[model samples]
Target: MTAERIPFNSYLALPEGKEFSVKFKERFPFSVNAFGLNIQHNFSDKYYMAPDKAGVEILVLGHIYDPFSGRSGEDAVLEIVEMYSESKERFYDILAKCSGRFVVFVGGKKMLEILPDACASLPVNYFSPAVVNDSNEFAVSSHAYFIREAFSLPLCSNVRSLSSTRFYHLGIRHCPADMTEVEGVKVLTPNLSLTYRAGELRAQRIFPRSNRLERDVNEVINEVSRVLLSSVDCLAWFRKPIFCALSGGVDSRMTLAATVGQRDNFQFFTFAGEGNARRDLLCTKKLSQLLSLRFEEIQLSNVHPSEEFSVLYHGLQGETRAPNVKDTFARQQYFGVNDNFEVRSSISEVSRSFVRRKFHTAEMALTADAMVPIYKRVPFSRKWHELIRQEFATWMERSSFRDVEKYGYDWLDFYYWEIRVGTWQALVLQDADYYTNPTVLFNNRKLIELMLSAPEKYRKDDTLQVMIMSTLDGDVLKTPIVKNFGKKAWFREILESSYLKAYQALIAR
Candidate 1:
């Protein structure tokens, strides 16, 4: 290895005794050439300086899923390297077009990342790994828990608990990323990110959302299938016979359908976590049978309300998608996402049906408390609501989101796809397994833009999903919708709202 002092040799245990080091400035601790070629040093190995060459430096933690073919991490980096002498735009194009669900630290004239694992794992505080301990001094880390242990300090109380609504909202200044919402079909782009140059006072780039609108479900299906096959190859590199994180919903159903001929190579896994998930479990079984694929059911029992339990399958109760899925723990370990890679469908705003009440104003999109009523039981955070507002304002000042309302959709669409699906969901799912989502692959940009830009009427109801899914198996469409499975009493919302208001009033007193 031709690196300087290898960083954190004893602390970061790599399998097979593989070592990595870099010639990065201490300020930029994680830097590697385009080939994922990194050097390790301990002041003892025979080494020589690298010959000056044209390339980009990368410092990434965890495997970075790429939509450009099946290649990932350094392999993908090497391919891009071979195509061109490194330039900021070339690196930017690769990061923007292919990378997903990783902590990236890119260097040259600038740095860029997408839900960086270090800070994504601990959204509120910057984290780093080191050989020694210093309680007061902080660094970036993949596991924030270890940093606290290393310092022998009390668990931090300076950080506020993320409300269920705000779990993956945005990685604000002091809040951990949490996962929420819908407005005129608005969902945050869990993958949208920014670029930074070390000395520059401001970010150099804020990646734009796809704006092309096509009404064809065939295009949607084709793009999804492409992401599936590519992601399957990318994920298979880590684990075998990929398992689809299947559910009864459109996202998972579409994911399965997209696999088409590849069905024999996969095992489908679904879980029942007390609510609509129970319905999802039932429907998934039926769907699995139709596909003639092996299915594994992961059930969550001993139901009770804790900080962890959530009304929404997508909740931000803790650092992971689930806080205490006790029954599924063993199964997850056996399937081992870290040990193996799994692909799941996220950003199901495939249809406008997700938007309960159409929103007309940008302010209402971000500042409306209890934006989603049925999910009101999920903890709400005015702080996060405020953050959403501030983020929109700041983003508008810097990007094209300013005229989001001028489009067929409004600010909500931009926020949801760019911030929620693009960033939040990806970060929240980090704890369970290394996951890939066809819905968010960088290469699916046009499909995504077309989905968002398609006329509102085409998107209304489950028109998009039904059109696509019915083509595969019309019978599957007959399954009961999870949230709407059992009818609720007409007064249910009234009572829930009153109870919530009284509780809030009491808290104020």
Candidate 2:
């Protein structure tokens, strides 16, 4: 291997004759660094970055574990290294098999590649034609180390022709505009791979489909449960206490119950808002107490209407044209930020600017070695919202989701680039210290299958079904707080009110 570019708190080495280079955003924010044959793992308690011999890199940002056995047994970095070495040639195959919230970039001896998890947990982007290299240059992964130094421009639409990919308009945190030229930019799609080799670029799918050998509902449900259980169990790689976000909803209720029986070293966290049901919290508290496990309740105050624009702009990161006043306020309250008048004005202006400046095309926002900062802020205006809605609708129409299953894929589709990738991308890039929702790493598909597979008796009686699903029989639902509000009428009212408020706010904004 050549020593042309020294590793900066990193273990990046190029093969003989060929050289490698890197630029850090801030001196590699990690604790310990370990290296294996052609691979370097930068470990931090919160997250980790690993790069292998093939120049493929993976950045894990959230709680990832196997859902089945509920064990943190697998070594993700090592697995990635092994996978890349064995299947380096099959780009999409490598990406589809990896687990966790991450951005995977595979750069072979001559090709630059990018892929997101099948669930779109992390973000990745690309730009071509070396504004710095002049030779074919493309970047992948989450850092700007390669773009900031490699190119001399702020991360925004430097060129206009290439800004049509789906990643940028969706408010993805990893898609920056200052790194590469717009005419040469592309955001790699989730469950897909972009390969740039020998002056040619191609995109391909990697995830495989189920055999479609029809089976009974019971059988399907069992398999679903098994998959989810394994997925969660595998990801719980924590020596310290682990926390889960508990909601009074079906998805969360079952997850909490399963976790209780699966892992002993676990705690649950719930968020409480004014006028919201206490059932989930009550259940979480009771379960924790009963299990002799630790639990915490994170309470959020109500946010006012006046501060809606600011919160929405920031949370959505200049994308999302719809302005749901109550939703915005709710998010602000949940995030525990003061939404004053000045904050509103600043955010509104930024939102408006984003609407105005966003060229109706795809482009590279940054170079491979660019720094991740609050570059182009989103603007808030009715015109911006209208444009965004229309554009988003069109993008959805063009989306290619046939490759993935439609069970939990609804969330993946309706959310695709917007909520799933958008929300976390912004969080990871903005607040380095913040943690991600644990439920994300679990096997949600299995949960959905379980719900859909229930007998007609339980499935037909939605009320009874929800109650049963709220918490493990006595652990969560037995609490006084949960008992008081778990009534069918109250549950129905909560759903209706929340949905009504969301709809009204969306239209009003």
Candidate 3:
């Protein structure tokens, strides 16, 4: 667990007979020192002992698979420490061979530190009362939210929120500290370190993805897939009981299929909406059954608009405004809602926002509802939704995506930054960071390249036709449970005949 390292003296201070607790889910290599604690989760595995080792008392909540253990948790941590610096290399080398999420704590010289993985797919949180003290550090399942709930602080707001508004139009409260849900609090960033000592605090970034795209597409995709699959396998490492979030989408289905028959240690859970309202849930169920895996479907119907709004509120926090959701009246008006009434309900105030932006209402009126009728007649609405979703996947994308040719940076970079990082940041905040691969958006590059090089073959199926044709194998296609049950033909017909045809016709015209 040494690929990433954090000093244990960051977030701990001791009170007499101080009994502290650390709790982590799906993270590993839990460690504790007199001054602080170090926990390794999915991403990295090593914990740094206090450089200034004093009587550091540490407590940690770790996983059962932790490589080291003893009669007491503190002793277990000591057992895992590499006493010799030279041997440390080999020690971590072995640790890297291990995977999963864990939490560790170390405290000494009046400091406490906790480490979560760079890609924290697991569940972990920290909460401390608003008052800062020597023994005030706490860890929970949802750090910012649990902390805010524990301390009664309003959510933080920062540039991330604004970025979401301008592009994706969603408010998010759960971005890392680099982003503010409120004024002062921040979530720790991936591959980041936080040191709290002497009533003074410091934070620094330790890991960053390389900016260069020197590697070939095959290399990039292979490496990315390895890292991602390792993450998935680690989360599914638990033996006693395991569960996965099944979204009934391509992403989640791929994840489920990869694990099917691979182990008996896994279970799948999905949320089904009432009737047709929860098409995703139904689809997920259908897919799970086909896999013959243990499954649980949690049906949710009549969810208050507030619940979705709450997720948007705390999820994106300030990142989204009323103007972001197309379903919302304000957002519709902002987008010339009247023109797309059939696509969505119309708003009477479209002219006001359009006028303020110096847009001619009459011009927009011509195309406002243009998508609705066009969408209805299109044979590829389903495929179009996916393509558009990819385009608008990240909050900052919309800014540079339009007329991408005029933009300086590679359109690939724009797509990469938005989908891989920005979108995940928003999803992580919502604790809904499921199986969406940020890197997959880059697939468009491959598709485009292939199309340019060999347009005739690529154009034969088009995008929708290609995806549908590939679904011939029920076992291989990874469709969700409901869709697999009977909706396969239904979905195919709808996507191909109605949406796909309309979509292709629009493009041809």
Candidate 4:
């Protein structure tokens, strides 16, 4: 972690996406050889390299909580080699078994290109963070946010850039994995790009398998409990106080319920006004009392909007801009006084979010637009649509989710977890010293795979989540859901749209 290796805001991506390309080397200090430019200044804390095998280099900017496997540093490297040697198909099986939060770097001669982990918890943003691989060098970082934050690069807000931004927000990286060769350099997608001199490319989460172990409600509860409990134990915060954002909703309630018998190290908290326990606070307080845990309500009525915006700006390093949501970041940072560890039930709602409650298309089919509400869409030219189609195809291939009809139409689960949760929430929380969800903390890939693999019927209507919460305290099943989009919510949305780009920002893809 020397001064020379301080990780900058973003990487320099040449021929920037499908729209425009600016020579950033003119503004920044770096060279662009066919291979790649070598920019030494970085912000990595630890570096893990496998000299004995592929000579892969893994630089950990954040923490890696691989407690269950009992592996760290070089040992983890050796395990990677063995996994690569064993089967390319099962690479993530071993990867998921080793739980941690990291923006990993594994590069060498054996592996032509240096690839970051598929699910990076740091160096992330709301939109897709990209990595560029050229003939001789490797470059990586969050693209748009990086450019804006780092060099103050003025970006295009035309239809193409707008569509690009929207797609990137939905987990499609700024640079497509198609790798349109421009002067021997390949601007690769950030999510598990399987191109290079590698033997073969195997997408991690292909189709959901028929692994329905939780055939009954009891089984579902136990499995959910196991995943959450294991996730809690997987954190590196030994003997530290655990903080959880307790909302009045089922998502956080289910998370709290998982820690039912193990409440010694737990603390339930809510955020609202000075004394008004409405919506999030009211529901959270009632449940906290029922659970017999101290309801520490953090009143944000006194906090200034300027203070919140400041925390958010630095917190995300200018990745996402939401003055409206900045309060959450500020409040979390405020309550979470120390760097113990925290839990956030982020994607717990994705399994049953506004996107997944019903099918978008009339045919009950999932399309590129149906993934999530892509804001601010503009008319696409022929070439632009072609590029978008290419991007969509690439997204389908990488996800291993070929058919939404066969597996499930709830693509929002993946969208929320990969793009929104990892990029926005986890990225900022990690910076604020709050480690997120158990499925991530523990890297509980088995449980994740199982949950994803379950039939749509079992997955829908918050079936698993309700079972877990009700099992713990059925009274909470009746807890009023904080209506974020109710009569009171529309004003906020209208205000946001008006203050923002209005139609351009409000255009849902």
Candidate 5:
């Protein structure tokens, strides 16, 4: 018998009524409905499982790699299923070791659990109403539009009215980690698991199981390098001709170094039209020549708006701002047409003190007002500011800040991990799922924690990435890092470094 085929941009629907189910059925003819839920997705048979003797069904959307066992695709899925069947704690531990961009759905007769990857990189949004329905109706989808459309929820008035430029300036690239443009449709933040059972929906953190351990920097770097190489190897097993996104930045460089063993199966490329595209191209070309590797430049031109673009743009429901529309569209077009996997270093920022200011410290009291300046890059109306403040407060409360403190984790680093990379970068990947596949090596929870275990000084100076590159292949660093736009940019870079050093000295004193 021929196997079933699932398309891209899949969604899981558990409608409140039969009417919505019919709509979903019509939209996705190749879906499975059982245990009071319906799942329609684009994953292959390797990523899916039928209901077993225990009446449990599993579906894994996107790629997953088991670094411990060096498993990928079907084998990894089976390993996950076995671990999950054993116990939730074992499953969570396995998840911590695995690296990829995926969301796992385990559905049984009376309960359903939605587990996103460490960074929530695949974007899981569910309809969480103000009032409970006796039916225990719930809907979760990678695309928030599915939930909004199924529930017929109205767009948030505050978000819909903003112009595209204003939207971009407000830095509202996507909704807050916990919010969606559609009312009651909230995003599942990283390190948290959501459960729907007995007419109750609950979300709880699944990480930071113990207090932070300040490990030796060399030890952390050595372990991280080993895990990253394993991750790249696993990815290479599932997909061939992988493209490492080469850039002048440390993140991409570190990723490039990880591909050393799998260089034959990998190529390097940089997208044109990005802010540092030129510098990236030059650096990538030099590295390719030095390393004797294959390289390509993907020009972002001749990209006219299309009906599909319109659908995708609107489907985001104001989550993605206007300025990024074209870039997003073009990249999707390239990846969708070419059918290539792109390796990204987006999640690595968590290890490098991203979104952190020198003044911020572990001892500083965290509040919504204090976070506002860090979260927003541009000015907004008083109303918008207040709304954002409220969102931050809610996020802090929902994320269990008290637990973060108890775990001895720095609130600022945790914020960058959960709010910035977990939410922002995850949404970006979800949008990219429309056309292409992007994987991050640092998406593993254990790896991220290891990177974070290093002292703040090492993280601030890009020491983690530097050490990783040095360990993997020190020659890659022979080329100076990209300093874009000549003297002005150089001066700005020096000034920023100087300020950070000065601030650190003051704090030490």
Candidate 6:
């Protein structure tokens, strides 16, 4: 595909007095400039605007699902507008019940509010210094590259040297949750709402409401299964073709199980590559054959990245460089199958204590020092270490980390949800907008809270996933999951079991 054929679903927003350049205007024709805000998007349906009873204009970009009313797309947007019009104080509460990848812009008479989804999956990067400057010329975008270009911002010095070598060793590919590669620009963290008033912009936490009650583990599991299934059903309600990603992992398996009744409306696909990906291709083929489901395998080896592909990939992905850019391009080409919704299971990790170390206890204090090692496995230079440390500290300060106990949350789990997935996985999905319209069935805020409320033992194991699959389709769990590749898997399983036994014995003491 040529660069011109690449879709630009992202948007850009600027203050009232400022205007997008002629070049940008030509790219993004759908726009609304009113009530102290100027916003533009490439797709008209993805951008919706309506006035509330009070005449305050509410603009929404991207899709949303309201499980309560079984509403999605434009209907969901209207519901949000009505809810905000009714009670601004309960706006966050209303948002907590909905799920999607979206960024909302509410331009009131005196203030403008920008609300990202619970995971900030759509990503909002803005020029921080401009937000409070005397000229009030703030700029925000779904793509960080746009923000950098519009403001002539310098790239963060540390990010310029980032390469796939560092990522392979350290698992550090993206900036922290509260930062971007552009100097003086920051990303809006998950569960936080941003508002501009009196020439000042402020972001505040909105979810994990204080003084919440925990439920029984079984109850939480059952409710989570219901929400997961309902979310998938809601997606099918759109009458659009749905493509569910199938892998040999518990998360993707559960995502497939949730589509039990909607099998006729969905197709399964997997990426064929080395290691775990090859296993994924094998397992998905078997499962799909057994269930008589439509399936396709896209070979990652077929990708040959060109210079033009690199420029387009970097433009959409910004500073987050994936080693699989060629494969991503291949997937984008495969999306020619149809204009469909891609179901991903990436968000399911939030409930599985994903960031918790083997020996770390729930009571252990979460600090920048602790997080740095988790992200960067190999030792690095002092400058890089300090950069990673400072970035974690800033993210911790901006998030609700200090109040985790008050909200009945584990600090490590909170870190995984707010920082790890919120930053890294969210950016991955944003970059994938060029490839496919992706949605996570497990991204509902209430559903995630339900997963977190379960006992850690259940979450750490595959119990939660198994239980949900059992409820949806018992056949899904019949195929063995491919955890590793080849004879190495046998020895790795033994080592993992021995390590778990040792840890359990220590805990018993």
Which one wins by lDDT: 2 or 4? 4
lDDT of 2 by residue, 1-509 (tens): 12122111122211232223342323334422212112232223233345555565443433343343343423544454466667654323333334444444444446555555444433444444445456554444333223333343343442221234332343333333212232233444444556667755566644333322333545544554455445545545454345555555444554554454555655556666553444666566666677665566876555554443444233322222223335544544454332110000001011011211222212222211111112222223344334444433433333343433433222222232333334334333223121222224331322333343344344322332344334333464444334324566556445544533443345323
Q: Write the per-residue lDDT of candidate 6 for residues 60-92, one digit (tens) a residue.
A: 777788775677887777777777877875666
Q: What is the lDDT for 318 in model 5? A: 56
Q: Which candidate has the top score in TM-score?
A: 6
- Candidate 6 lDDT: 0.71
Q: Which portions of model 1 show Cα errors greater than 4 Å? A: 1-52, 59-61, 64-75, 79-94, 109-205, 209-239, 272-278, 299-338, 350-409, 422-424, 434-447, 470-509
TM-score of each: 0.60, 0.53, 0.43, 0.64, 0.87, 0.89
List, residue by residue over 1-33, the lDDT tens digit for candidate 3: 112211111122233243333322122233233
Locate the minimum summed-lDDT window of 10 residues in model 1. 40-49
Which stretch of 10 consecutive residues in model 5 shows the poorest summed lDDT?
1-10
In model 5, where do residues sit more than 4 Å from their true spots?
1-7, 15-29, 50-56, 130-135, 161-172, 274-278, 317-319, 332-339, 357-363, 378-382, 483-509
Better of 1 and 5 by TM-score: 5
The superposed Cα distance between candidate 2 and the true structure at residue 251, in angstroms, equals 2.2
For residues 228-263, what per-residue lDDT tens digits would candidate 4 score against the true structure? 655555443444567776776667766676676567
Q: Which sections of candidate 4 miss by over 4 Å?
A: 1-50, 53-57, 66-82, 98-100, 107-120, 123-135, 142-156, 159-220, 236-240, 274-276, 301-329, 332-338, 358-444, 470-509
lDDT of 4 at 17: 26
**Between candidates 4 and 5, which one is better according to TM-score?**
5
Candidate 5 lDDT, tens digit per residue, 169-211? 5434655547777777788888888888887778888888789
lDDT of 1 by residue, 1-509 (tens): 12222112101211122232222233124333432223211111111222236334444444455654667656765654444345645554555444444444443434323223211221211222222432222222333332233333343332324333353332221222222221111111333333333422222223443334455566665554466556555655544446667766666666666566556677788865676455677788877777677888875444443222232212222233344444334443344333333555665573353423332211334322323222223334454445444434554544455445544445555555544444444444533432122222222433455455445665655666566555654555666544333345225534555645653444211
Q: The CA-based lDDT of model 2 is what? A: 0.38
Candidate 2 regions exceeding 4 Å error are 1-27, 30-98, 129-134, 141-187, 200-202, 208-215, 276-293, 300-439, 443-509
